[model samples]
Target: MKSPSPGRSSAVRSMRSAPFFTPIRVVFSFAGPSARRPLSFFSPTIRPSAWRGRPWKALRLVPLLSQNFKAEVVAVLMLILFFSWCYCSYVLGCWRLNIALSWFWWRHLDAGLHAVMHGDFRTRHDIQAGLFWIYSLLSHRAMEYYYGARELKGNGMSKHWWHHIYPNDPGRDPDWSTMTGVAWVRRHTSAQWHPCHQWQCWYWLPVSMFLEPLFELIQVACALLEAVASLLEPPMNGPYVSRWAHVLGFLCEVLFNPGFQLVAFGVQPFWKALGVLLLARATSRLLLYPFSEVQHYMPEHILNREAADDSAEWVIGQLLCTANLEFRNRWAWLMDFLMFHGDSHQIEHHLWPAMSFVQYTKASQVVRATCARLRLPYYTVGYFEGYQKICEQVKEHRKPPPRPKRPRSPGEEPSPSESSSTRTRRRTRGS
Candidate 1:
């Protein structure tokens, strides 16, 4: 074996000295309400380091329980701003700002999904109604129409936890289904390869970036079918199982909802309304997808549960699987805003899933320094570098896997050369 460089050897020694997987002791104080309850954590938590204090305390700088209303307020404000923007752009004919406002609104709503994890929003009903209305009216998604506020919040939290629990684990992580290219476009994992994926690297960018409308339309079509089914025979599960609510929700999605933006656009033609809706969704996806994907798509980080070393500490697995975007001091806030907050500092988000983005920003320094001191892998890349990294990963998987030769037809025997080579290969595998 070749000898490692002096720097590489020293790095290895540091990592070995401070192992990544450190046992975590969690102590829960059950005296208070579940949301307000304080969790006492012993150190060497997440990963081994000299630090002995509660890591959650550092991450949650804000009074999350008391300040949840503030998050709800922000959500309401975002909804107002989006509608206000829609009025100015769509009604007043300032259509150039359409994509920009829609994109911002979409990002905020997407972040609202994260905000829901924090829990106990007094305005949950209002917020959920606004969100459902926005998606249904603008994106023509009937499924959103069916789900009420509580269901939306529950589903969002469950999915978020699942993704964090198994970040970057193909077949296990729910996000993988979306990340591994939609429809025919495939980003092959090591365990799964297909010939179509050979050209994925070449066309993925253009297709994903520009053709979001087509995908959105497909989703809308599927949702429409689902909506019909629900109306005819309501789901046996979920709060809104009644056929009456299904009919009402479907009506709200289509024509009767006060939240519909087309009315503000002033009696626009059906095609025009649909065109605007598609354009909005397409632009939002373009702005959001590329940045949102950067955290998990790093080739080296995507691993199975066994390979991820989950036995050590799940938090260690999170750190390994997730990456962050490096931002300059002056532009960190801007990047955070653009990346839908907390997403730029995804390691912290994964570490403290319940904490808000404000806390993520505040605690990012502590987390980064902790990782550095512990000799843990804390991946961060520039925006361009991260995007290029994703493309490189796709390109790396572009080669089609070698296939075995077809068996000799029915009764026919293989050639003598083929039989001998097969026998030798089988023996080698056995040995």
Candidate 2:
């Protein structure tokens, strides 16, 4: 036989090296380089291989629901449950529980009674602190795992990890974030009232102990009922109740109970409950306002500010004025997670909002490194420490000492620089 041509020999060698030298390869081998023109088109075929076959199948289910009445019914049911849970946990559970519990505790106390009435800060601290811990422990593990898995799968960059990872259809992009009503309220209020709002202290102090409890109680009852209903009924495995009942339950147990308890017990005078309620409403605005300032108000942190110019700018502006409390202590971490770790992780969450708690630690490490490189402050501390700092600032602002005018040096004129230096010295002296 004639010796194989060099091209043929090379093709034979390539065939041996290739993983699947099937009929297609043989056909291509005979077609020569001119046929290679079409091979480039086949490259995209490999891209689909990266996704497991199941992901595509799973993704196909998204569009099925939009076509018929059954799907719409299911969708509506899911939405209702979601709204109910949100209302119950946040509004009634957190706000109401705080007021109820606080009122209960306060009824028996003297006029001078306070959270510190139990001798030390332990009683009041325990209530908030315990709630925070419980919330963190129950929710953090699952949330972290869910979030971490998304990060590992290259889907952790978005705000709502669940919807993105398992998108219902082609119409929606895989990485979209949705804001609930409460979240919206929190964001808008915080953004509108920081730094420039001199009434922040007056707003937050009393409200936390009164009006918030009533709303919170409504949330709590709703959550409790939903959870109980879930346990009694064979889980509908519906979109709303199946996946999120635990979230509602956790919120009720952690946030609602303590907040309400604090309100009831922390404040005194049964008649003052009205004042406390008004204060609670104002403080709700204050807490949310500062929170929004830091997250939604700030330009860098605002999610979709460009679309809604006013809202976006408002959020960015809030972040600029508001400060974050970074918790570092293990206990503090536990407490914050329990009470509403979201508040504690505000800065980091804004920085890498999609990362799960597990991945958040790693993401936070990277964040710390980046912040260090940029010479920016990374405010991470213990929960208690952060809370203490806020309290101190509030207290200081509320009862600021009258600034005494500087005594003019005998026969010497007071200069602007000298006055500033004197003020600075005084401010720092005790602080």
Candidate 3:
């Protein structure tokens, strides 16, 4: 075999050190006698390096927990506890609780709107007249339930209706890939709001708000009835079955109540459910518009038109398409969470969508470093600061004054000094 050039030998050695290309380097090393001297000299050191050692050690340890019966039992117990708490909290409303609460108010507003539209303006105050305290309590409960269900569904790892209803199903696999499902939703449904586009109608807003309160109150009443009924039933034998029942209870609270609210009061209520929905929509647009522009609209990150394959590029595309929300102010963090702060750890979520929110922050530092190496945008802004900027951009886009087109002159000649002055002005403006 011919001797390899020194540059080629160095390049091969470098490629071998890289994690993914290591196997290729090993193959090349064995194929050429000229590769042996450099390989033997450098390969031993590379193979035993701490960088290589830690990952291999960690990989080896993963199966040990499964192999040991005691460890497996402990793992299962921990998993049960974790999921149980998640289910209870989801049913009880730890996330987006305000939305559920506002459902009651939405019902009232919806009713009033309907009454007004039907030329019953006198009924406007009637919805709130006798129902103030009841509506308020139901609203709070509904908000709690709404946020709880959202968190439960998000944490459940499945986008399916069945999974939302019975999340703790032992047969249910929580690690199913969300990319395809999320992509389908993004393509078929609006990213900023629910898949149903009916909420966009302006007239429905008041009606929804008016009727939501009453609808939510009925849901709460039904839930209490179901709980009392469950208590009267024979106790479930298996732990899984009991867990499933608890999950079902939460599902009942979330779906049955809200489901009835939508169906009985009609879909018109969502249109008039203005307070929380409006705030949520406005907050989301403010956060996402600039975010989308920076991550997707920018020339550097835009998806290629000619490339039919969206495989490897899509992963990179996600990293490029999302930016981190860095909060400088303490209040910004609270506000961010209130308005989809899950977005702050976006890159990590994209990389490992199944990971719990608790794990996301831990993974963020590593993900950020990886993104930095790739030269992708890792956007971080103080919560309110970013929100304010996005609002400003929206206002700018909305402001109307069309620029007049400059008229073209036929064979216009400019003096050298005039041209130089214009060039200077153009350069200054460009800078």
Candidate 4:
């Protein structure tokens, strides 16, 4: 048999290095809080990197001393979470909140990370990627418990309960208002013709990785303050009291918010720990945000209208507004998890927020066929292609045309200079 060509070998090598094509790189690309490092450390001595070296060694007797450690930490996590959900609902107001954006990575994801910290870089990468894959799948599945059955059972009245029933109202879609990434953009719905949006296709990887966290800092302050307040609040409407709970919780959140949970739990120094965590988050966001943020912004979606109006039928509204992404590749689910089922088949999600990511794909086919049969619009594109469209649309909107150059008179002849230029042009063409 003939040996494979040299060009094919080089092509295979190129594919591995091209980060977008690498499943491991793509999944870990957003290893921020969602990567879910531990909440607190039992041992202040063991380096998290070292924990990966020997997790058994890192498990000291400290956890045994505090029976309530898990409970306290879990409660704090819940507080930050609850405050966030409440805040988003508050901002979007009652008009536009169908569901949580699947944003929070549960405490168990962190717990599992702690348990499996012993591994090589590759092993740890797989663990972080794998853990989210499993947990998000489960969390979204559990969404049915809250949103009702997978079949879209009942349209309960409460804001949280009926999310799947009415997923993507321009006024009622939480995603447009609170999805994540840069505030005042993407998640924050605003009339925008910023040059940044125009050039996002070019600037996304760098600007997103570095600048986004600062934009997210406002959220950090809110979470920490809420934790602080919860700590200070008088239980059962009693008087205020200072306590260790308030201080410790505030400290943990402040330290932990910028991917410092590893610092709290493991052996890394503050700067080193933060630097490493930031790098991972930056890498993750670089790969993740453009696609995630651009979903609703795609040119044809027309989601940025200044005022709400009669949208299409609720299901058609989802298709009209949400960008359907390609994720049929074998490892695309990891990317799906990073993005919280993201734009990758987002229509399937909006139409049936109750469906698991797996089910979303199956359902997308049926939805697509139905849309085709009914002659409805279904916006599907490659993730990068979708972002390109958003940038172009933003650019198009930003540029106001030159005052439509006052129309030339119908019978007007050219000026002497214009006639000379026209003759010159004709001579050049003749040549």
Ranking by TM-score: 1, 4, 3, 2
Residues 312-398 of candidate 3: C-alpha lDDT, one tens digit per residue: 343444454445666566675533333221345655544333232333455666656655665655655554555455334333333
After TM-score superposition, the amount by which residue 198's alpha carbon in candidate 4 deviates from its true location, in angstroms, is 9.4
Candidate 3, superposed: residue stretches over 4 Å from native:
1-314, 329-341, 385-431
Q: Which ten residues in a row have the lowest lDDT in candidate 4?
A: 34-43
TM-score of each: 0.66, 0.28, 0.30, 0.45
Write down the worst ten-residue block by lDDT for model 3. Answer: 114-123
Residue-level lDDT tens digits of model 2 in 318-393: 2222235565567755433322223455444432222222223434555455546645445444435444545554
For residues 1-431, what per-residue lDDT tens digits would candidate 1 score against the true structure?
11112221221122123322111000111112221211111112323332234643343343323235554565556566666775676566555676556666555544554444232132344443344334333333323222222233313223444576678776667666665543545455543666677788777767765575566556645755685665555356543334444444444444422223445345566667656666666666666554667765555665534576645555567778888877667565564553344568787766654454555665678777767776777888787777676667677767766778886688788899989999999999999
| Residue pairs of candidate 4 with colliding backbone atoms | 29-284, 30-284, 41-265, 46-267, 47-267, 96-172
How many clashing residue pairs are found in candidate 1?
A: 0
TM-score of candidate 2 against the unseen true structure: 0.28
Clashes of each: 0, 60, 36, 6
Candidate 2, number of clashes: 60
Root-mean-square deviation of Cα positions for candidate 3 versus the true structure, in angstroms: 22.1
Best by TM-score: 1
Sequence-dependent TM-score of model 1? 0.66
lDDT at 69, model 3 = 33
Which residue window of length 10 is worst by lDDT in model 1? 21-30
Q: Once model 2 is optimally superposed onto the true structure by TM-score, how far is the C-alpha of residue 217 displaced, in angstroms? A: 1.3
**Model 1 spans with C-alpha error above 4 angstroms:** 1-73, 120-157, 179-182, 190-197, 210-212, 225-229, 232-266, 329-332, 338-341, 404-431
Q: All models: lDDT?
A: 0.51, 0.34, 0.35, 0.40
Candidate 4 similarity to native, TM-score: 0.45
Q: Model 4, 8: alpha-carbon shift in Å?
A: 57
lDDT: the better of candidates 1 and 3: 1
Candidate achieving higher lDDT, 1 or 4: 1
